[model samples]
Target chain A: MSTFVGLYNYWIVIVLMMAGLYTVIAKGNLVKKVIGLNLFQTSVILFYVGMGKVEGGTAPILVHGDGAEEVVYSNPLPHVLMLTAIVVGIATTAVALALVVRLNEAYDSIEEDEILEQDPTT
Target chain B: MIAENLPVLPIVLPILAAPLCVILHRPRLAWPLAVAVAWATFGVCCALLARVLADGTISYQLGNWAPPFGIEFRVDSLNAWLMPLVSGVGALVLTYAPRSLAAEVARSRHGLLYGVYLLSMTGLLGMTVTGDAFNVFVFLEISSLSTYALVSMGPDRRSLMAGFRYLIMGAIGGTFFLIGVGLLYMKTGTLNMADLAERLPAVKDSRTVLAGLGFLATGLSLKIALFPLHLWLPSAYTFAPSAVTAFLAATATKVSVYIVLRFFFTIAGVGESLGNGAVREAIMLLALVGIFVASLVACFQQEVKRALAYSSVAQIGYILVGVTMLTVDGMTGALVHVFNHALMKGGLFMVLGCVVARVGGSRLSDLRGIGRRMPLTAIAFVIGGLGMIGVPATVGFVSKWYLVLGALEAGLWHVAAMMLVSSLLAVVYVWRVVEVMYFQEPEDAPEIDEAKTDEAPFGMLLPTLVMIGATIWFGLDTDLTVDVARRTAAMLLGGGS
Candidate 1:
């Protein structure tokens, strides 16, 4: 039961990760790919956050009411790391959207197969 | 006091300069500012390499926090060698940009291009020096983001599509890498590389650790454009502005190769990573296929720049072949090839920039009378092509020689033979350009006009020639690169003091 509980979240992470990867590889629409990329990144973010959680632990903040009070806090490092990763994910999504916008303008189509069919050069 | 700060300066200076370029957005002023700052970064790299030589490894803890608790910037022989090569290329490419970019990129976009270029440079330098796992992903994304922007800035509309493709592939690569790092952190509870290295061995047998390693390899291989994953490279390189192509070709994938080595040998421990026969043999087989397939694709290219782009993939194969041998000499060859291929390809691409600047296209027919038109640029192209072919007295020869010696060291004769065969194939492709440029008559040249005898302006020609000169000069005396590479290879294989 403990093993099942411990492994369940990771199983979800893998499923979500694979779903994102499959979307990216399977979808023909550029915008869909961007969304897929976001999903992929979000799955990793979840993995990091899930790993940082400590059961029955309080927030990662020290109480100053009593200097001698025993404290139990979940690890805060993964949360800090995810903050940066979230920013990166946002930056990547922004850039991908911007590129898609430009690509749509230039090619008059955002569909990969149509664009290739319309193109001349390999 | 000044020398103590060299480690941090290279990363910080360009980042500071990047925004300054944006605020001071006059194309004329921004470019010179970018060039000056890049040269200063190169100077810092030189000082850093010297310090690493004098003192074994230079480590700086950010905010004076201790390692395992704080981010550290560590400079060992491996990074010491990469530092000068990457920064030197940045300085030279920035110098070459003003002329090479004027024709291909819009005049309005020059300031923004330089700004993105500096950001990319800062990211590359930061990625090289950081001793933390998470920091690598940050810097990788920074560089990848800026590189996509720089590539999209090309005048051709197709550049947008090319850049979009790269963005998708590169982002997937980055996220995969992030997943891998997160797994490592979960297993070890530390982001510091040295800390991870020390702890990974204890849990090396864990399925999680093995999966993490597998993800790391897959992610980096995608980033490095290794073999089957190389679909995004040729179009991206072919369509980017010449200056961006030169910069990315010289540094980006090479740095990706560095990241792979760092993760496998330094962070994961060599015995746990490369000691796996499956992994070693897989990398070798993929590299061999990449070499022959990319070479075959290169042989049939109609455009010179795209041909060299395919050729870059094959050259990357040479580096990987060296790495897979896992011998001292093989690693040395790979390390030196990192620099040698930079000089050779940078020069080759600059020559292509000049040719394209003159004739408006890099098609084979357009190059027919290019030899007579721009003898200097044409000859530099020839010299670079010879280097690519591993002709003696060129930097390419030095690395290939080391690689072959390494193959023989491991009693791998067929691998050595394959190297020779690919090089001969290199001669065929390079010669295709040569015959058209020098031997074919101008009238026989197709599609483009009979080009006038016009030389590339002095600004661009000078830097390209410097690269060509270094290629030949270093090929003869492998003193600086080979010496550093030998030590670096030893250090990477866990033999360094």
Candidate 2:
């Protein structure tokens, strides 16, 4: 395989990662920043799941009491860990959204720059 | 029976108790429940630490599954020493929190607040003891998410901004860490730290492995609030409820430092490239820059809490610089600084809580003549401040002495000189508070009345005094802090203490 084809997935991961990072940094809306954070985490989950895949690998389970032939199974460890990661991502997103709701109640605006303008200490 | 599960009890106790705090739900019941669980966690941690000291390292595999296959908790001297500091502070803060939170937080919110606090404590303890790499990330998120919620509980609307910023930065940092761990797994196909240690060396030269290490360092640096990555700290600390501030300032970033130390020394054991000063030098350079820059920034902050928040970054710089020295004394210095900084900073922030509770403001201008009004709290703040400046009789001095000695031993005189200069900068910022609180006339603001301003409540005063007393006692008697620090440092530099 050519280098570009071989490393294409990682390149996609980088693009998605950078896009998420940029949205977080560049956007001023609090909810949008959270969306950016979710995007960033989603890319990471993809990277881990992608890394664990094996060519021609089937589900990581064994056939019992049958004509069981040689079967290649994808590494399941990353998949299990990513399940935890996705849960963490969900928890973070939930918390971030709750904070944004609280922010809106207090400030009457969810825009980051507007809030900073109102909060002189910032 | 649970003694066999000693390695996991500190974590399990808090995780188990946190949900109970929520289910108990009545504010009065929840406060006591949280406080009880926090003290219980400390008791369990002390037992775990004692066991580790007697037997060396304790490894408990989950569900009777063996290593490299199931999750395990392995505690040695390094984390055993840290466990009590985290949980002990949790206990004190919770004891201190009820009265303090009564004044600051709404009556209705107490139940949910304590519940989150307990879970946050569990996360810190779990991350410290876990032998699995992915387990650390999960616990990290557990702590960070809860902390974001806790900080948002502040009275001011701006606290939500602080919470939002922290969530964004923290989420990015967590993802980076996950990516790094994924890369490591690709290289070695293992997630257990001890297993990784044995398997990593063969692929140490691989680009993927190197990139993984780099990402891990970067991600941890952000979480630990190292120099340029520290933008989220000042506001978060400044705006969080006083009790939450005291709890987090004492433990959160310190746990992140423990994780970084673990990854660098334990999992990537004895590699030439890692042991060499290549990455260490860069970290050293950043640490030096952080010391001066953060300290300088701290001197000019208008709010006492914000100033101290910046000071926290500078203090972490001192600890990181010691680690980069790659010597026994340096590691010892870092370990000692971890304990000392927690004690001093926790005390300092608790004092702020007392001041803000009575005085109605914490800005430097509003704090005039506080030294006269609240004598005990003021005195505690002074001792804590002196400790921050590395005053001769305080705990900070002992840690700084070892750090400078390590630098000199390493033949890095310039770094040693910089360390002294940065400490002088600490004195300037600390003195700003001392001068404001002591010498100036009590500002004529409505909040400041000469006789009306009384001491903080007895409950708040007690924990603050305990932290202050420990700072002085630990500084004078160096037996406990220094002895454990030496053992921990030896473990980091060599295989085992």
Candidate 3:
């Protein structure tokens, strides 16, 4: 199944993962970092969805007429796990963004380096 | 019903306690509720550990559905040890949190803070006990979110920044971990860890398996803050409220380390093309680097909490070093160090919190004179610091002894030398504090106003002293920790490759 579509999907997920990681590491702004974090989490969702797909295969749920025979279907476990992961990812993003907002309110800046530059005694 | 309910009790108790804490609304009620929940979790963990120690393995199916289809909680040697460390420390830390929170956090937010703390506790405990790989990610987020809230409760405004930094890193780590789990599910068609373990060997040589392993290791390493990846840790510890710093330093990274151990030695088989010598060697190298670099950095930090924070990074290195040795002795050393470091660092952070309560800060300069005025708290700090340096008759030495023996058995003299050098470095840093406290004269003459303040309040002092006692007690009695570590190591490596 190393067709163009399959390979392209894989490439897109990898690119998204790398981009998200780069933002997290390279960005100095706390808000940007959280945004990057959300991107990173969404990349995982892409990966799970990619994994759950099959070549022309339907969902795992049985139809009325196809009952007696074993039907080839895309894997359902990744989809299930990904659903839970999506919920977790959203929770993490909400909390992280909330933290960033709090940080902005507290420090008067969302930039990490600026916050670090402020003396503790001040 | 209670007998059958034993396995999930550790998680359930704390989980139920969190919402109850929020609903109580009264600040006074929050502390007791949180403490009671933590104690209940500790008791359940103790029972579960006892059961696991008696029986080989116990799998509790949720809603009576079997695994590979339903979520399951598996209790074995590895988690049996971790369960107690997380829940027991949760209880101890909660004992100190009320007074500390009152001092550093806003009065209006106290109830919500306590609720979040309990939620984080539940999440950490759940992470250890759950057998589902995906469930690990779910619980990890649960803990991480609450931890961000708890850390941000610090009086210093910059604490919000620290929490944000931790949140970014933690979310990235969790995402990477979820991606890894997804990849594994694609290859194996299951989410249960046991089933995945069984199915993985067949696809061991596949690119998908390797990719999954790479993602999982990288993710867990970030979570555990392995060396270069530890940028978020020191500030998080330093600026966080004293109670939050102590609890997170004790439990958060230790649980992550447990996850690393579980994945590396258990889920990812430990030999041949999969586990391979290269991966172990790489981990060992990074761990050794972490030991020297973090400890040396600790030596230069002026803030007491930041120093201990750097030391925590080095301590993690020691545990990773033990794991990399890949022998029963090595793994046991790593396992034991997890508990020992938690007690030592937890106590040290608590002492710093007490100092913060008294002096309004934990800077080295601030501590110069107060040591004379607060003898009990200073003594507790010294004991805990000595344990950090692996002083004889402390739990730290036991862990180092096993680590050294493991390295020797592996014929790695240089690695053994590195551990010794790191311990010496630990001595230097600990001695820095000791010398400042005892040798140097107070920066200001003790006035009557300051002289009468003997020590921190009982709430803070009790937890610190109890942990100090544990450091000494565990140092003398190695049977329980060692036996469990041996069994866990055997279980992992035996079933691994």
Candidate 4:
């Protein structure tokens, strides 16, 4: 029970990852699939943020002075990396949505099955 | 100063030019700018490869920020070989693109297309140069997103569907890679690849590391389009503008293969805690299956581009099989194929592009009597086909020679036999196109003009022939590609880190 509680953040991560994966695989609507991908990416972001948190740690602001005591601060690198990842995620979403919009204009529908029915080769 | 900045130049030049292209606002201006920058990047790559060959590995800190803390651009013989191939292919295809894009993409959007093409090339080159794990994901998305846009620029609605599918799958692959990098960082507290390599061994036994490896392998396999994960590739190749197809077929998947080599052999040092034999055996099994299945599938494709796209999947299998051997000769074979496959496949796609430009379609039926109508282009296709079949005196034969030698060195007789048989499968598909082009009469091919010779324009033909010429040149002169590949294989197996 202690171990379960201790790893609760990880458990949430796994659950979210699975839900996202399932939605991506099962959803036929292209927009819903993009949302699924967002969920999938959000889980990874959560994982990074969770891993960066230290017990009672503060932000990684450097202190200066003769009396400045050593403070336990959370690792900032993962957070910084995920910030780039968030931007990448947004870019990916934008490209995907733009592609979706074009696909809809061409096919008159965003349903994969409907689009494929219209052009079997696709 | 220029020599010192070699490691970053190939990546920096193109990315800097990408925005300049859009700002230029006219393709007449943008196209020339793109070509000049691409050639400059290739020249820089050649110089970098020469330096790496002479001085050993060169590492540059981005903004002079020392690594483990700042991003590093590291170049060894491995990436030195790849950088030239990527930039060289970009140069060739960009030189050939204006006419091709003029036909396929809209006139008003040509400037934007050139911008996106440069961004895609930048992303691939950046992925090749970076020594940081997270940086790989960043560059991968940059390339993948631009690639989706480029594919959608194809004339038909199918291209739109193809591009959308690729975006979805490629995003998933990129995210998986990000998750893998995050896992590694959680355990090691560093993103620098070399630093991660050094620290990984201490935590080698951890479940986190194993999970990271799993994620990395799966994600890279998707990106590389290795066998089962390759569903996005065929249509993506089939429907993209001819120039985009040629550029991507030659470079994109090969870069992913190089990354796999980096992660498994360099960072993880697969001979250690990675269960080398088990992992190698699994890859070997899949590669063998992929070679047989994809080759057979290629034999049935009606569209010439689709046939070659399936053949690309089979060729990737050949590269992976060589990688699994884990011998110097085997890795050498894989590296050589990485170079050789680009020449042959890029040349073949250019040949198809020529046919598409002239005939307006690449279906087998459309190619009837093409040998008579466009003798030079048809003959180029035949030569490219011969290379695919691993015929002697061609680049494909050279790579396969090293591959078979490697398999035999590893005492994998059956794997070597399967490889030989798959080359015969290539003959079937190539023959199908050859027969249609040469033997069948052009009376049925309404698109083929019977009045005068319709060879591809001098600009397109020159690049296509140059690529085909390199195929034969590299095949005969084993001194360059083979020597570099041998040293690279030695370095990789000697723990390249």
True contacts kept of each: 0.72, 0.92, 0.87, 0.95
Q: Estimate each model's TM-score.
A: 0.97, 0.97, 0.96, 0.98
Residue by residue across B281-348, what tens digits does model 1's lDDT show? 88999999999999999999999889999999999999999998989999999999999999999889
Tens digits of per-residue lDDT, candidate 3, B83-127, equal 888888888988998788777888888888888888999899889
Highest DockQ model number = 4
Compared with the true structure, what per-residue lDDT tens digits does model 4 show for residues B1-497?
88878888888898999999999969989999999999999999999888889999899999999998999999988888899999999999999998887778888888988999999999999999999988999999999999999999997999998998898789889888988888888899999999999999999879998899889889999999998999999999999999999999999999999999999888999676333678779988998899999999999999999999999999999999999998888889999999999999999999999988888899998898889899999989999999999999999999999999999999999999999988999999999999999999866556645677889898999999999999999988989999999988998888848
- Give the DockQ of candidate 3: 0.66
DockQ of prediction 4: 0.90
The 10 consecutive residues of candidate 4 chain B with the worst lDDT sum are B270-279
Worst 10 residues of 1 chain B by lDDT: B444-453
Residue A114 lDDT in candidate 3: 80
Candidate 4 clash pair list: none
**What docking class should model 1 receive?**
medium
Q: Say which prediction, candidate 2 or candidate 3, comes out ahead on TM-score.
A: 2
Question: Which residue pairs in model 1 clash with each other?
Answer: none
Model 4 residue runs over 4 Å out of place are A64-67, B273-275, B444-451
The DockQ of each candidate is 0.76, 0.87, 0.66, 0.90
Error of 1 at B236 (Å): 0.8
lDDT of 2 by residue, A1-122 (tens): 68889888888888988998999999998888888888889898889888888989988897666556767788887888889988998999999999888888888999988887888675
